[model samples]
Target chain A: MKRAFIPLLILGALAVVSAWLALSFGSVNTPWQTVWQVISGNERGLPFDLVLQLRLPRAINAFTTGALLALAGALMQVLLRNPLADPYVLGISGGAAVAALCALLLGIGGLWLNAAAFAGALISMLIVFGLARGAGAWSASRLLLTGVIVASGWGAVIGFLLTVSPDAQLRGMLFWLMGDLGSATQYGVGVVTLVLGLGLSLPLARNLNVMARGELTARALGVPVARLRLGLYVLASLLTAVAVMTAGSIGFIGLVAPHVLRLAVGNDHRILLPGAALFGGSLLLLADTVARTALAPQQLPVGVVTALLGVPVFLYLLSRAERR
Target chain B: MSVQIPIIETRDLNLSIADKAICRNLNLRVNPTERWGLLGVNGVGKTSLLLALAGLKIPQAGSVHLQGRALSELSGRQIAQICGVMFQDSDDAFPVSVLETALIGRHPYLHAWAWESAADEAIARAALQAVNLSDCAHRMTNSLSGGERRRLALAALLAQDPTLMLLDEPVNHLDLHHQIDVLELLTQQVAQHGKAAVMVLHDVNLAMRYCDHVMMLFGYGEVLQGPVQEVLTLDNLSRLYGHPVRSVETPEGCLFYPGKT
Candidate 1:
């Protein structure tokens, strides 16, 4: 209990600092007092608009997207009982990328792209689920292999679409592929908040706990194993789709956040889920801040920054787990 | 025994795998208060029969009934509620705690939205205590020894509190003391709770000593099912194991020994 409480406190402090830094420090460099006043409904002119309209939404988007992806990744790993499993392993991000690319090439704009991404993710998940089931039962190995096959297939399709796309839109597609948080808006942030908050909170947590036990044991214990697995895949795909649509394909947050949290805490989903969410959100917010300020007037894509930061941390964690 | 409906019954059951016949024309009826030992050599379809009984595998030719209702008519959850099964091996090599593993036994009783209630926790705790693993409740399962893992699996089955328990090689990795302890506990459960238990035992002596009834399967899909003494005779044992066997009766119980003719 003592150990558990200390990490929580540290995480809480980190979350606060990350949120504050994200809100106060940006390209315009709004003062803390003005940022506070703007947040408190006082008008502070153009700087306030940049703070409230641009930075605040961007920060929230980074936070929620990271948290959602990480939680989805953790849930997938537990459900599939494979350490390598993640949101992308199930072709969710690939499906969403294909949909987004299609929208870009065909000149589709606005919410339709997000909707198409969600639909593509759902369809891809269903196909994986179908391939995973044989003789009315699901095998984890089969599910994983199916995910890999479908993801590569979708990747090829996405590549074909990019090849045929117009040159003017090609640069945007490349930027989206690498992932950028510049397009995050209040509307996108709201969607991410609603979906990630409600989708991954309680039921998924319990289901994941049941799933961590082997499937046969879970079935004997009264868990509807097949149904629960299907539900988790769909929910994870939805959450990943939301993140993919909002921030493009921000890579390792999903893989790294949950793993780091799992190392700190054990594999209990109730703790791992919420902890992963908070840490992932904070990590992504910090990464976004670094990306924004690292090179003045030439912001690096948030995805590149996350990958650069996450790889070393992931290696350290792996060695630490190995030593233990 | 007072007249109560049989908890599990299989009639002329035929099961096959990949077009190879495993068990054919096998019939079994287990009273609600009986503890039956299923004994056979390795690869004699012991695990397959247990799977069929647990509703995990479908029979090719016959039907299995639980309390006079066809098992096929019941949902998996309903079957799970009435029958607890401990498989030979589970792939849960992760660091799930013993308490968490045992709590999964309460899954049949819990609603999709409801958390584990206090009553559920109490049941799980009692099951752990029964297996002498209460001290290790919060310990990670992967850290447990082989014997401890087997006992923990037994504890998980006990936590289910099912009317019928079907265990496939429940004592596989257990030491001598734990094997006796688990079998004694099962005996007490049958005597006190009137619950039925069907377990596959590799050790014939252990089966004969603790089991009230025994089912011995031989080659060519033949099974001898009756009271332990009648079904576990030296002649039947010799035929089943394809060896000469001798039985010695002592004050404790009967013991079988392999011999050359």
Candidate 2:
């Protein structure tokens, strides 16, 4: 227990540093002293507005979104008992992408688009859940297979929506599809959901550890496997929905963050869940900071930077794990 | 004899897989300080019957009772407190240390928000030591050999420390020495702790040497059960396995093998 704390504390420190860097370095490049003054409420005017109104909320949204995705990814992997399972593996993101694209074609923007994406995610979850639970016994492989097939169906719809839409809206649609934290203004819901997801999942962490072994073993060892699987599916899907609604369909963090942390902390979900959240939130915050500043006035989608940064780290961890 | 309540009892229990009948009208009682061996042919629903006994599978007819209460009335945690099952294979979907895996045995006893106490860790360590896995406690489960993995499963069950244990092919993948070692450990647990065990075994010789009671299931719901001496006759053994069997008496016990045509 004591050993698990060290890595988590380090990740928490990284999260703070990442948030500070995100607030300080941007298009205007505010000085650290001014940033600190604004944070401590000792300053006023444009720097204060820029720090408090503009960057702080965006940073919170980015961190919360990243935390949600990573937590969802960890849950999906455990529930399905597959390392390849990600937050989007069950078609939740694909469904949101399709709905958000449709809303885009219909001249919808802002909050309505978020709502549509969330509805689509829930619909997709239900369909996959119902189909996977089909006339036979439910299994992880069956759920995964159903989810994969449904995601492909959603992909075709998204493609059709993109091709048929007006040429003028193409760039915005593409940015959203590729994941844009630029328009994220509502960080409150995302923050709440991240906290709730982490809080609820932590108590079930030991059951999740047993579940990683197998459903049969879990049941034998006193875990109510059926109920736990259902709860996990719902929780992970809700987390993915909130993430997509907050920042379109940010990729890589959901898949890679948990994997990297599993190497550092082992597979104990008690530590892995929160650790992935911190590590993933920090990584995305840092990635978003780079996305905003690296190209000057032109911003790269946060997804691109996430993959760019995450792949090398994930590969390094994998190689190190192999050597060990 | 004083009438001590059986740890696990099945009343008129019927178990089947698809069209195959594993057992029918089976009324079996496993008392404390007893080790019962379940013997049958491959794919004859031995595993299914074991699962039913463990309250993991619902019987096709009738019911099972644990500690004088209906098994259906118990929760998963409640059943786990009384019964521990060791599966044939250890599913390692993610990497975890051997000691962590053993610590899972204390899961049923702890509250949702509670961590394992120091005494619980001691129990886990003692279990590992019993299985000769103390040196490998910190090693990852994936690093263990097949025999070592088998021992780890046993260690986890030992840490669970239930009154009744249901083991499916406990000796599978084990070397000869480790197999005997594991069975000896189980026997000692049952005798010294007043525990009960129902294990499925393919090796008739080992069952003869270790188990005091035997239950033989023939497909189509046929079964013969009694004290090991009365139930382990050459005729019943051959009929149970659908093959001719020959036995030779030894100082230890009677050893049975296939008859030469």
Among these predictions, the greatest lDDT belongs to: 2
Q: lDDT for each of the candidates?
A: 0.81, 0.91
Query: RMSD in angstroms, all models?
Result: 3.2, 1.1
Q: Can you write out model 1's per-residue Cα lDDT over A1-324, one digit (the tens) per residue? A: 243466767777888889888887877777778877888888678977788778888888888888888878887887678865677888887888898888888888677766776677777877877777755656777788888999999999988998888899998888778788886664555454546555545555665676677777776666667777777777777778778878888889999988887767877676677777778889999999999998968888899999999899889888987887
- Model 2: pairs clashing at backbone N, Cα or C within 3 Å: none
Candidate 1, after superposition: displacement of residue A57 in Å? 1.9
Model 2 alpha-carbon miss at residue A126, Å: 1.2
Q: After superposition, which runs of candidate 2 have C-alpha atoms over 4 Å from their true positions?
A: none
Question: Per-residue lDDT tens digits of candidate 2, residues A146-254?
Answer: 9999999999998898889999999989999889999989888998999999989999999999899877888998899989999999999999999999998988999
Encode model 2's per-residue lDDT on B74-109: one tens digit a residue.
989999999999998988789899999999999999
- Count clashing residue pairs per candidate: 0, 0
Docking quality tier of model 2: high
Off by over 4 Å in 1: A1-16, A99-123, A126-137, A154-171, A186-201, B72-77, B117-119, B219-221
